[model samples]
Target: MPTRLLLAFALLLASLGVRAAAISYVDEVQPILTQKCVACHTCYDAPCQLNLGSGEGALRGASKQLVYDGTRTEAQATTRLYYDAHGEAAWRRRDFHSVLDAQGGQAALIARMLELGRSNPLPANAKLPEDLDIAITRSNTCPLPGEFAEYASKNPHGGMPFAVTGLTDGEYATLTQWLQQGAPVQEQALTPTAAELSQVEAWERFLNAPGARENLVSRWIYEHLFLAHLYIEGGDQRHFFQMVRSRTPSGQPIDPIATRRPNDDPGTTFYYRLWPIQGVIVHKTHITYPIGSKQLERVRQLFFASDWTVDAVPGYGAQRRANPFETFAAIPAQARYQFMLDNAEYFVRTFIRGPVCRGQIATDVIRDNFWALFQDPAHDLYITNAEYREQATPLLAMPGQFDDIGDLLGLWRNYRDKRNEYEDLRRDTYAAAPLPGWSTIWTGNDNALLSIFRQHDSASVRKGLLGEIPQTIWLLDYPLLERTYYQLVVNFDVFGNVSHQAQTRLYFDLIRNGAEVNFLRLLPAESRQAYLDDWYQDSGKLKMWLDYTHVDHRTPSALYLPGPDAKRSFAGQLLSRYASLDARPDPINRCSNGRCYREGLKAEQRDVEQRLSRLASRPAAGLKVIEQMPEATMVRVEFADGSREVYSLLRNRAHSNVAFMLGEELRYQPGLDTLTLYPEVLSSYPNFLFNLKASEVEDFVGQMQQVSDAKGFEAITQHWGIRRSHPQFWFYFHDLDARIRETQPIEAGVLDMNRYENL
Candidate 1:
């Protein structure tokens, strides 16, 4: 066993193709799962509560209970992976069944499941059999070890990868071999580099600094950024850490305070610490934020350098914790406003993607696609006038204080009345002193303008106004922005009973109305009511409830220009003002007036873009295919030189108004629906994927345009779509993932396929 002899033997084994069993689970096997399995297995909607994002989650195994049950009468016990339980035994005590066999035998459920998929490979290059249900609402068929024989016999297609193509041969072998070896938990500890350690120390010291002002500031920062995957700027980007409240201070082992909400009482003195995040980063929940010496200096300037004093630190009581205005009022309003304006996209994402993994009720309050603009702090009435903020404080109280269903009616009444009073006061203020032109709009930085896209249950937010002009626009000021953060991110409870969820949704309705009304105030007085009527047509009695008449008609907008389409004119003016910050003109859709070409695109890519641009021009009303298309479809064009590019085809469904609580389908206006084409992936959840060769681009576009029925659509899909059962599904997926990482390394993660459509 000398060193030279050992090296020779290793070379001999490699020559004979005898692979060793020392495969790194963290480096190899976990990556396969992340790319192929984690899509449907990470969040609350994870199938059977089986989370495969981490080693701990894999060992914790699966549960029969559903985490997102909407019919529950009371809050369910939280089963957060890292917090609720620590080991296999703790999970077993809570009724979770193991998927791995301790004996390193073939009896392991995971092993058998993989073997089943290998033995019964899906039909190649075809639609999945109807028997295999892959819908998001499908029933959980979590077969236990004893029930595997019956389950497989009944549904042979149901395997580890589920309805999708099975893992690659190499990936299958690596995973099966690891499982056969008792699935040893051989993940290495993610030790920080010296620089990372130094940065962590500096951050912990700054956060745990003594004094009431510092304590209040740290608390505020933590509550806002508890969900952020923070990394030290210019350090290892993959090595992200979370800001956690630990009972132990810096240099000690973190004893994290596992509270339901970030602001919940820790029941002890806690220090903010940087805890290394250990898992595969999933796009659905990953919100990246950078922290460094520069960020530290910026925060100091925004909060500490300013002349402000914290009279006392706020308590974690429900009333005080639920209302940010009440809690952080002592902080200079301009400082707080600018802090969020600096990273408005990150804060907006906290509310849009932070609260629930899948929430139609919460998301349905706003339109599918909208542009959001913020109000400048200097021009914001609430931020400049103390009396206005004092009056609005009581009206801003959020829901979820208590989780009783009986409180819904009473809470609704209280919120409704207070909202009405606040609206009247706002109208009177604006009437007394109208906004001076576009002065109210925050034009400080790129984050001032935002684009939000709702892909049904899930959504995404990106900085800079994107796509064509949207149907609705939000003009948020300091008070409105603060209220949105508290209402959606702080108070929303995914595990709460029906009442809590409903009230959160109800409160957001008011916030949405306020924003839309604020935007309407910028239009000419005569055009305001007409716009409201069009936006809320066929809303029925809900119109009366929403109270659209409260808009400020007495105030004439200083920026008003007389035109038939005032909205379009106003949007054009704003876009012209921020033209420097406009997103890179998309080669596919934005080049309609040009030759549909860009400097970086190759000749073939330019040709493909020109052909595909036709799909974006199809009239929404006559194009029957629009109705059949999924919310988001990623189209990949493979070139002759083996290079490829991906683009997103998003269907922006039109609605009369996003005001109603249920029956969302009734409000759909197919005639007004439109398609937005982006020359890159724009959503975390893609419902379908279509792969075509550069030569086939024109044909694909032609087929898509001619599709008038389900049968015709199926024909088009068979030719161009990468259906779940296609033999090359994994290949296309890996290519798409690589392209995303290459283009957007800082923002990319494994795209979730839970919503990947059967069509």
Candidate 2:
């Protein structure tokens, strides 16, 4: 009897040991995953769609299709081995009773694998719970509990998404655990979440807000972006397109923010007079077509022509002023005038598309219609173009003795008086309850500035004081044409300089905002022109005007949008046209427009014919043709000893412009007006060149990597804004030659030449 009892005890102990062994992760299961799964499940590219190498990937796969039964026979009972799109293993519960019985048996083993997979860290601030039950309850949901929904409720315009199925329930629970534990990231933080994703959608809606006067924040953002647009157009005042609209502060409810329609034109009034001005400042300028003659004339008369005069005034009292029109002509730089002509021409050509031979007639008619570009010195140009003049009339008159730069004496006084008057309105004992649209008037306070800074780092300003809705440019200074989107600069110290690092962070934010992508995909191709183009178009050309009181304007107002379809269509047409022009065939005779004009009759005719032939051939090309070249295909390194080492393109597949060496030596080759690189080496060494300027080098490393063979030539650009000092960086170049080479001849020679792609 004693022997039998001892045998029973031994059997019980052995059973418990086997059970524990079956459920263990480190001792029992990880070895299986390492041997069978790690081989193909590593890195971003997971073959067989299995990324078992990373912990997160492993758990994510828990609810995915996997081979549960060793036998691959049709007759064998197959299991629902993987999670569904929503990360739920609901199918598993239905098919495998043993798997669902977590209290004991095989269910326990399955639970152990899942728990082990949960060890991976989630993204920063990602909501995670320690209790498995809580995680399960919260998993497979979108808008993530209270956050995004709460945000949406506050801002009626916040269009947030509610459902997200990017990960599985099990993966989310595991991610939550890691996140709640402070996300002990082994590599990078967790991926985007449903709530964060909703925020992105909300951002888009907010970005698309009407830029009408009614929308104050949107207007401020637009004005800031206009600065970038001006940079691209050139700093010339003639080319600057300024949009000016003013309204009483919100509390005064007498004239609602949206009610001050300048010109009655439906187009202009849509954004200017009404609450929809917010949309104008944000998304409307992106709604472009060929330049409108009426609008251009208004802008030109207000800004460009010398002959134009302010009310009751001769030219500037101190200076010997010439007739605005005659003086403009005497400037003798036909290049400027020709740009004006071309802008008007393109506008008419695009809008009035019947006969090619009628260009002279069209030019004559349009020129005559927009004659304000020449300006008559006799009349009060200010009255005719009051819409634009008011934008920057320096609210306070100059005391004549004050210098214009930095501080125009009368300006501050005017601003102060205006502030005092606005303050008095708030104190009105019987001020009516603020109108709904009143909230749109944006006053640049710290909170408003901070909000904008948090959302965007770049903004636009008008060329003069006023033009159209304030236009803002986002994501400037890239190797390619930066997309123009609505954004606002929240802060700028006096000199208008943002650190390069901060600027980069801003760009990162812009990209994350996704407005750049939307604008690029939607804006007209011509909109891609650099600051020089923006300047040229705006300077002295009268095809579009900053009309304050036109009845036929097409710009949308705060009260109404042209509707999504209209906005999209308008934006799409402009972008398509611009894209067409960008890809247009290069002119055979590459001379300045002035020279081509001077060559006269025969030359102009020939050039026109050639352009026509090319236009006919491609049928699809952008208007402005600028060439972009790829980086380099090879690099030859000559060491101090004079022995040269050459790294040639091995596979024409992933060639780039810049090559980073292990420590400090940056190997670069400039060919065909583009930069090319060798293999970039990343390492840590105190004395190495790499370490000295690691931050600078780090900023450009990603750009260098982008130079694979597939994309040869990309545009190089610098940030142009008040906040950024416009630090120049080589575009389409491989290495930072300034650091390694003394002469720095590459920039001087290449400045005028078109950067070409490496073929």
Candidate 3:
């Protein structure tokens, strides 16, 4: 062969190979559609309508067709032809058949083309039809079930609807069966092995690939716990205790709102049940007492009784007679002021060491620092500057020293240390083995801290505190702190949904405990500054703006630069504070924009009023009168049948034939000391209907004897049509006359013993 002839032959061979690799509808696309799209996309009864399973029917629709890639129709796509014209020279190619013909002995080429087009494979448990019609159409020639009724007669249209149609349902089934049996190439061609498919299948299983474990873990921890943020009635004293403890006439459990946290204690176990949600703003003063006072009282009352448990108080023994909430609340404004002053004194004693600290001057300085620290809503850890303290600390001082600048200036390091130590002495109780340089201990990973707290387990605590917080934290901004707490709750279901309502209280406790461990661990600012002074010889350069008084820095002593300078810092600070840019009132001004704040206050008031009104509107189940326990505000009663119980108000308790449970219902008694029960029991189900204000407790019974199992119920839970997770046999018969006028109709009374068992 001549050199030019040889080059031309090589070019021809390359062109043929490229054509063989291309994904054509006939050779590559049809099979994928048949396996995946047809099951849901096609209507079996409507054969003449669109059938996505078939290439011709899939793309030939006239009105709002499915897959239009700008130019070609699905029917047109069935053909393997491409036209190329240059002036007078026109060339037409039948690429699919040509590639197949050229690569007649190359089964690998065909298999590779199929592999490239099959990007996402169907799952192993995919639902598929038993029988399907495969239409093989090319240009004007078509083969579709509806079009091929008359195969023999040809009136130019070939007795077909459109295009050339060929395969019948039975013929297609046989072809599919043969194709699925390895779609064998000629004997001379190489046959791909099953192992090759295993690799392909593994690669194609994208959803369940490498990163899926994390997603699965996340879904498992968080998907079911329902959360709602709404204003509670009558401020924080909403009586959810009565609501949760109510029972139905049939002695069934009711309180659906109760969110229980995981319990790990070896001895006594307790659930952090649903309490009335209370909201609090950290800096705001007045909103504090109204919301928190009643809650503290309730928590104290519950824990004081034999039912609940609380581990400790801020600076007191765990077994102390006084509740921390009460102790904290009992401190008069004067005492609180003195407490802050005493804290300041302690801070001065520790850091200044040799006192240049005049008592009043020290108090004034600490107050200033404390105010500055409190002003920073983000609560960037440590009022003083410290770096890398989140992972490792240089010295142990106190929380507010870095965070409460007012205290820092008023009282030095010495005072801070003493105060912290004193608080630690008050709260520490040994529940685990001692570790080096630590008083009390617990053992758990950082991820398990919230759970440990929920379990109130000391060993678990030692474990959590021993490990590092997976990522380095620079600053402890309120929002970021919240994010960490949220993740903790989600991963461990720690406080269950209890923390959602008590976020402020929980975080305060966490910070307090952290302070007990090492005050510096909780606040890095004090240490960060110390680190900067130690490392940066050119710290003077960074100090130029230290004197500037911007919006953030109102004092000459304070530095207001954004945290972790992009150029100079090595460790990024946790100063990821979300700066508010919108029109917020000048916080210092009592009423910067009176209208907005007024409206906000009004809105809050309206919300409380509305909630209270709705709660008040809830029909009292029944009345009761207490005779023996005249002073008891609420009384409990057991029903005659022993199936139901309720609580009622004391006055109502004495008047009615029944006794009450926590003051909400009348219980029936059949005997001498008989408590007469009401005809029906009521339990409140929150968030049931649209736009409804009141809580609802629709009649519930042992699984309705015979009820309509809504369509798609079993299908969703089924592995296959034949097997379901919950299965039952039941029939309900309705009393038609009684059901006619009722709003919540007694449609039918179900009598399914299996229904209850299945549930």
Instruction: List the candidate numbers ranked by TM-score, top first.
Output: 1, 2, 3
Candidate 2 stretches with Cα past 4 Å from truth are 1-569, 577-759
lDDT of 2 by residue, 30-129 (tens): 4333333332233211222233333334333322222221122222222211212212244335332221122422223223333333333232222223
Q: Tell me which of candidates 1 and 3 scores higher on lDDT.
A: 1
- Candidate 3 lDDT, tens digit per residue, 699-732? 1101111123433322321321111011110000
State every prediction's TM-score relative to the real structure: 0.94, 0.18, 0.17
Off by over 4 Å in 1: 1-23, 102-106, 546-549, 586-600
Evaluate model 2: give its lDDT.
Answer: 0.23
Candidate 2 TM-score, C-alpha based: 0.18
Per-residue accuracy of model 1 over 244-305 as CA lDDT, tens digit each? 99889899988888888888889998899999988878777888888888888888889998
Lowest lDDT 10-residue stretch of candidate 2: 448-457
Question: Which candidate leads the pack in lDDT?
Answer: 1
How accurate locally, in lDDT, is each candidate? 0.81, 0.23, 0.22
